[model samples]
Target chain A: MEAKLLLQDHIAKTASITDEQFDYVYSHFKPLFFKKGQTIIISGDKVDCEYFVVSGCLKAFFINDEIKMYILQFAMPTWWTSDYSALYNQTKATINIDCITDAEVLCLSNDDREKLCKEFHQVEHFFRWRTNKGYIASQKRLLSFMNNNVKIRYEELLALYPQLYNLVPKHLIAAYLGVSRETLSRLYASH
Target chain B: MEAKLLLQDHIAKTASITDEQFDYVYSHFKPLFFKKGQTIIISGDKVDCEYFVVSGCLKAFFINDEIKMYILQFAMPTWWTSDYSALYNQTKATINIDCITDAEVLCLSNDDREKLCKEFHQVEHFFRWRTNKGYIASQKRLLSFMNNNVKIRYEELLALYPQLYNLVPKHLIAAYLGVSRETLSRLYASH
Candidate 1:
């Protein structure tokens, strides 16, 4: 699907906007593509733009003090990803985002998002609705982590991203579930 | 402090609104009070309104399949609490919210929030900014959990809610840290 159409479809679900308004809104986004293993944002760098995944997969991950990698999220088509804490606060990124596969994304800068929200009421509503969903998903993720049930976590991950098994490597999925690769393999075999 | 004043001040930081608009927005919120240990939202019930704390503390929590308690968030004064997933999706609550101390809150129904956002662009902007902060906080919380260091989690919790130590009970804090009471006590003594 075209990036514009994907984004338009996403925004339309929450807020009503005319064709001209959508064109104006879409103009603020810059299309970018990355090959597999390409880093989009890295820890210690300043983050300005957030990506809307148009194709392929990307992982938002963090490295702990011990240098252990933890996958925070996987961005698939129509999903958004960013080191948002760094973007909103103008702080250095504490997380990294990279392509899991060759990916195309629409990048929207912080300034352009704010401008669009100010310019269009529907845009503001769409953003609010978008963030609400993100917050809820994050909260659910937190709850699952606190529960510390790896099997349930594995199931939830598959449910969230059904295409993930084929698209994402087992080790990456293990990192996302906070389980060992062997454990993920066991879970995979069981499923 | 008055609920309206607290809310108006909070909104002012993110958005600009006329006094008339502020008053109109304020009218939608209904003030309610709860005693210490009172339940506001119970798991399995329909969730409608989200509570903005005027005074005292509240906990948003979950009881796992094993019936173990996990604290998701502490809603202090000026903080909002709700089973947001349920409220947004119109599903039965999967988490419960309760007053940790005698508390006052201004409740805003989901319908009224939508109405307010539609009526005022600034209100919409305020909510978008509000949810953006929430999404960031939730993401940070998830990251901290993924890091899985109790000592660091304890420090971060204190840093987030400085007055929480004097106000909240120790066991609840332990629950938030996903640690046992003894471990929290050891961390407390070490600090």
Candidate 2:
């Protein structure tokens, strides 16, 4: 699908926007492509834009003091990803985002997003709806982590992103679940 | 401060609304009081409204199958809490919210919120900004959890909610940090 149509469809799900309005909103987005493993945002760099995935996948992740990488989110097609904390707070990124596979994304600057939202009530509604969903997903993930039931977490993750099994590397999946590679293998075998 | 003023000030920080608009927006909220330990939402009950804390604190939490509680959020004055997934999706609550101390809250039903957002662009912007902050905080908490740095998590928690030390019980604090009471005591002593 074209980036324009994909974004239009995604936005249409939450907000009612005419073609003219969507075109004006979409004009602010710059389409960009990344090769697999290409970094989008690096820790300590200033974050200015958030990417709306048009094709392929990207991972927003963190590496703690021990150098162990933890996957915070996998941005699949039509999904948005960024170091949002950094973007909103106007601070340096504390997390990194990179492509999981060669990907195409529509990049929207923070300023333009605010401008569009201010200009269009529907755009504001669309973003509020988007953030609400993100907040819910994050809350759900937190509960899943605290539950400490690996089997259930594994099941929930797969249910939420069924294509992940084949699309994402096993090690990355393990990191997302905070499980050992061996443990992930066991879950995979049982399934 | 009164509930209306408190909520109005919070909104003003992110949005510009005329006094008439603010009052009209505020009219939909139903103020309710809860005694300490009073439950607001229970697992399996349908959630309809989200609460904005006017005074006192509330805990939004979940209990796993084994019956261990994990505090997802501590809703302080000016903060919002609900089983948002259930409230937004119109599903049964998977979490519970209760007063940690005697509390006053302004409840806005999902219908009212959507109606207000549709009617007021500033209200939509205010909510989008609010949810963006919530989403960021939740993501940061998830990172702190995955980092497994208990000391950092403890510091961050206290920094974020300095009043919580005097207001909330030690056990609940421990649950929020995902630590044992003994560890919490050690953190307290170290502080």
Candidate 3:
């Protein structure tokens, strides 16, 4: 699918806009490609753009002092990814975003998004719903983590990203679940 | 401060509106009062509104199968709280909201909020930035949970809610930090 159509379709789910308006919105996005294992945004870097995934997968993650990584989000097709804290607050990124698979993404700069939102009510509506959905998902994830039920968490993970098991490597999935590779293997075997 | 003025000031931080426009926006919010320990929305109820805190505090929380409770957020002055997943997706609430102290709040029904957003571009912009800030806060909380540093998490909690220590009881503070009363005591001693 064309990246522009993909974004237009995603935006259409939340807000209605004419073809001409979509074209104007699409013009603000710059397309970018990355190879598998490539870093998109690194910790401490200044982040100014948020990416809309068109193909493949990306992970936003953090590494603690012990050097253990925790996956924050897996951005698949139509999913957005960024060190949003850094992007929105104009601060150094505390998390890194990198490609889990060779990827194509449409990048929208912070300035362009604000400009587009100011220019079009529907565009503003689309972004508001986008963040609302994101906030809900983050809260859900937080609840699951607080509950500390691995089985339930695994099921919720699969329900959120059914394609994840096939598209992502086992170790990466383990990182996302915050489980040991051995524990993930046990869960996999049981499944 | 008057509840209307409080809301007006909060909205003015992110948006510009005339007195007439502010009056129109203020009309959408219904004032509500609750005593300490009063429930606002319980688990499994249909959630139709989100609250803006004018005075006192509220907690959004969940109880697991073992009946252990986990605090998701504490909504203080100028903060908003709802079972956002249920509110946005029109699902049954999975979390409960209740007052920590006798409280005054301005409630905005979901439909009214959406209507206001459609009627005013600045309202849409205000809500987009509102959710943007919320998403960032939720993401930060999730990261803190994943890192599992009790001292750091305690410090972050304090920084996020400075008045909480004096207002909320010790046990509820422990619940928010996901620590035991004894551990909270140790941390307090160390502090």
Provide the TM-score for each candidate, comma-separated: 0.98, 0.99, 0.99
RMSD of 1: 0.9
State the lDDT of candidate 1 residue by residue for B1-191, as single tens digits. 78899999989998999899899899999999999999999999999999999999999999888888999999998888899999999999999999899999999999999999899999999889889989999999999999999999999999999999999999999999988999999999999
Please list the residue runs of candidate 1 whose C-alpha ends up more than 4 Å from where it truly belongs after superposition. Answer: none
Q: How far is each candidate from the true structure, as Cα RMSD in Å?
A: 0.9, 0.8, 0.7
Clashing pairs in 1: none
lDDT tens per residue, model 2, B82-175: 9999999999999999999899999999999999989988888899998999999999999999998999999999999999989889999999
Q: What proportion of true contacts does candidate 3 retain?
A: 0.93
Residue-level lDDT of model 3, residues B93-179, one tens digit each, is 999999999999999999999999999999999999999999999999999999999999999999999998899999898998888
Return the lDDT, model 1, position A184. Answer: 85
Task: Sum up the clashes in candidate 3.
Answer: 0
Better of 1 and 3 by DockQ: 3
Q: What is the lDDT of residue A157 in candidate 2?
A: 93
lDDT of 3 by residue, A1-191 (tens): 99988998899999999999999999999999999999999999999999999999999999998899999999999999899999999999999999999999999999999999999999999999999989999999999999998888898999999999898999999999999999999999999
